[model samples]
Target: MKTHTLLTVQEATALINAGKVMALAGDEALLRQLPKGNWIAGTIPYFIADEGGVESRERLYASELTQVGAADVEIKTYTLDTIKNIAADGPDNGYTIVILPARSAIHTEYANHGRDYEGMFIKPIVGWIAGVHLDDLNRAAPKVVDGSAGAVLAAEAVAMHVTLSADKMAVIHILNLFRQDPDADVITFAETGFSASTCLVNGKPAVLAEYLAAKRIDLKLPLVADYNGAQINTSFQGVDPDGRTVHFYAPVFPGIEYRQAAPVGDYVAELGALADGAHGGVQFSCNCILNYLYGELQGRKTGDLYGPATFGEVAYQLLNQTLVYLDVRSVS
Candidate 1:
């Protein structure tokens, strides 16, 4: 049986009818046409299909979850108030996959403070933010569907908890190609948010957007923060009309030192090389939309690391311009 790929609505329904627990991604209309079954999904028209990046309102990307969902699986929804219970409510020995509409209350809440949620980072958690067609940004709404309950949600999040056998374990992996340049000016913020006006550049107070302009910093590059050895990125969205405020796809936390990422060539190749040693281990994976556009991933490949190109990536917490994946392994 296939693990993941683009499937027609009829084909997906066949899998659903077979009692295959899964994760799905597609257009809102197509997703709404799916039959009730063991699955959870979010909306998105862009995907890194086996053939490469493509956008389609007719087909869906499906990842079979029978292995992880084999032992015991549960599908549920969470409102903004109940979203905090996500990590703590998962199976004791399994992992959780979640989806939330882009810019929804639950999405904003989880992206801003999900790291501090109870039981976070204790178990592997991975998912993507749902999004509408690029042209429908203002008119259309993003949604997540609870296939088992046949419920579609716009303001809420849907999560699937998959309990594996005692001998197996689930793990989350992040592939971030961007890293802080050693000599770049260090930038710090006074508050955490998706946008900032004032920030400290090399320890001197300065307007963030003005400083970036003065330094001729390429907005295509992201701000990188090092957590121990892990390099987390906060991608640039745009500068406000005032040119003093800078917006980011992900929030920048206060008290963290950040620097512009170093330049790199060939993101598609780099992404594949980064996951070279983990080929078959990746059971599910998703890339960021910024990468698809900025890196020009259309019609390119990332080896076995593929899925939808989402608005944002999530691995325990929100991430920008990165790839998030789930891998299951036997207990050593």
Candidate 2:
């Protein structure tokens, strides 16, 4: 059975602290419950202590800011003390904590642990923590991967790892969806292994536009490209199916700089065709950061720290918004 509720960060943390959630070898039940939305995964590769520099470390966070839509993102900083407090106080305190690390400290710790070390470590680091809320614990638990429990270990086996800016991109995507459909339900799905060019819509093969159409939901698929490759118009699409006329607004990829090279109008039209049963939408997938860097670093790496963390944030936002969209009444 599919679990319909989303979980908040607070609820998830409590579950972890209480030992309500358990890790399994490829737990399908847990994987199935992840929230659904635009999933974006990234990583923070561990460079050799001597070779690693401050500028490179800063670039990781800086790259996140450069993603397509990140302007309205809300970034917060958290410390070990604050995390300990949340563990003690419970979810009512109401805040998500993201840890950012000091480059020098991370480097020194990496040296002590040895270049080939593989383990999860969290202590003085710089990062932000943020998330939306949902009612159920099951739904929220997957969004968080605890480094301490051997659940989300670092790829390079270091003790100090922190979140950078890609988290902001996840936030922006959720905010955009909320702006469009305040009541839409959010769902998150985390990938332990990266798959290429395959996306599942409601457990079926279909693109975003096609899924929207199959449901008979009257909405316009926004054009995202040019018809003749002449010019591009950036806008969001508006639809009123009953009138038989849908309006394609300009393309909007706010906060993100690398715009989709294709014209917005074209993409919208393709989406409409999918809705009309005339075509199928495109499939999309992403590579895991660990897998991408595996060859570059020659050593025994155990797990993916950055990829799972990114998945956790994306899943958190999707599940949070989904509960809001469904207007699920609170349970005592």
Best by TM-score: 1
Alpha-carbon deviation at 46 in model 1, angstroms: 0.7
Q: Which stretches of candidate 2 lie over 4 Å from their true place?
A: 1-59, 62-95, 98-174, 177-309, 312-332
Work out candidate 2's RMSD over C-alphas.
21.9
lDDT of each: 0.89, 0.22
Instruction: Please give, for residues 9-109, the per-residue lDDT of candidate 2 as tens digits.
Output: 34333433542311111122332232321111122222111121111212211112112222222222223323222222212211122322212222223
The ten-residue window of minimal lDDT in model 1 covers 274-283
TM-score of every model? 0.97, 0.18
Assess candidate 1 and give its TM-score to the true structure.
0.97
Report the poorest 10 consecutive residues by lDDT, candidate 2: 319-328
Q: Going through the candidates in order, what is the number of backbone clashes in each?
A: 0, 42
Q: Give the TM-score of candidate 2.
A: 0.18
